[model samples]
Target: MSTDFHGFSSGPDSAGGAPRTVVDWITVAGDQLIATIKQLVADGNVRRVILRDSSGREFLSVPLTASAVVGGITVLAAPVLAAIGVIAAMVAEVTLEVERTDVDGVNESEDGTPPPSSPDPEV
Candidate 1:
């Protein structure tokens, strides 16, 4: 259940939260969907999650409130995750589209590494 990912250029922002938004596409085997989604949830910056089958037909769109699971939200999310798992298991492979925010300037790059900092202008 390996994954291949690519990021798309972020679009205009709406009122609220982090100033920047980024979208990433991850292609993964069906068995790995749950793990991927869980990791994204834990990242604490994802704004949305969309699952699509091999044909590019989207099956699920999950709108998350800035990736944090507060109290009873975790309980509510469990059923959604379970439903995603069941749908994923029926397909061979699927694409996961994620929209993440750069909360407090924390970069959520694909490699799990922060983007390089820029040189100070005064230097």
Candidate 2:
């Protein structure tokens, strides 16, 4: 399904492995949401993008990878944008989870230690 929106663009591909950092934030506008998404992807370190409502319900989760083939997380951005635009019109708050990868290729565990390495070749 395709919908027209001004300034809409695809996000970046993520690398395989555990994210180096998971950032959480509350946004009140779709534009901000789009900007944040684009910025995270543009940085070329993001591994996932998760969206949730104020009720703590996960609405969307985009697991990204650095492969040139665009699938998985890449296809969801448009729908997400459409939904966020609709939600923006109604004026609501949503939570954002941005998972970014580390440049050193170390997988960080929940305890903040490097875990086992992934076999996926770096892009």
Candidate 3:
């Protein structure tokens, strides 16, 4: 029998920009992989399944028996966990609020009069 696996990694760079995060990597992987496994089963060439991460760590393994493969709970759970993680992450974080002021808005003149609305017509 033939088996297929895929791995992925997510992280941020050192720059001050936004950080790289895997919001739904696991869920996407699980959904796609399970679909592939189902297709393989239909093709009659797959007998076992194994999923791994970028660190070469095996996250799940299962024999491709008719009943077990059809009723694989791990396959279903992976996406759920990933969804929860992503949702939690998306909801838990708050954005930084910065107040901006226009330099011209400050009344620098002694009289405190706003600058002329328009250039002097004579000038």
Every model's TM-score: 0.70, 0.50, 0.30
The sequence of per-residue lDDT tens digits that candidate 1 reaches over residues 10-102 is 544333453687677778777777766766676666778899988889999988873244432483367787889788879988888887776
lDDT string, candidate 2, 13-112, tens digits: 2254333453434343443565555555555655776777767678777766775124433654567768756654554555566565553444344454
lDDT of 2 at 25: 42
Per-candidate count of clashing residue pairs (backbone under 3 Å): 0, 2, 0
In model 2, the runs with Cα more than 4 Å from the true position are 1-28, 68-77, 104-123
Which is the leading candidate under TM-score? 1
The candidates, ranked best first by TM-score, are 1, 2, 3
lDDT of 3 at 64: 48
CA lDDT, candidate 1, residue 121 = 17
Best of the two (2, 3) by TM-score: 2
Clashes of 2: 2
Model 1 TM-score? 0.70
Pairs clashing in candidate 2?
A: 14-65, 14-66
Highest lDDT scorer: 1
Error of 3 at 41 (Å): 1.5
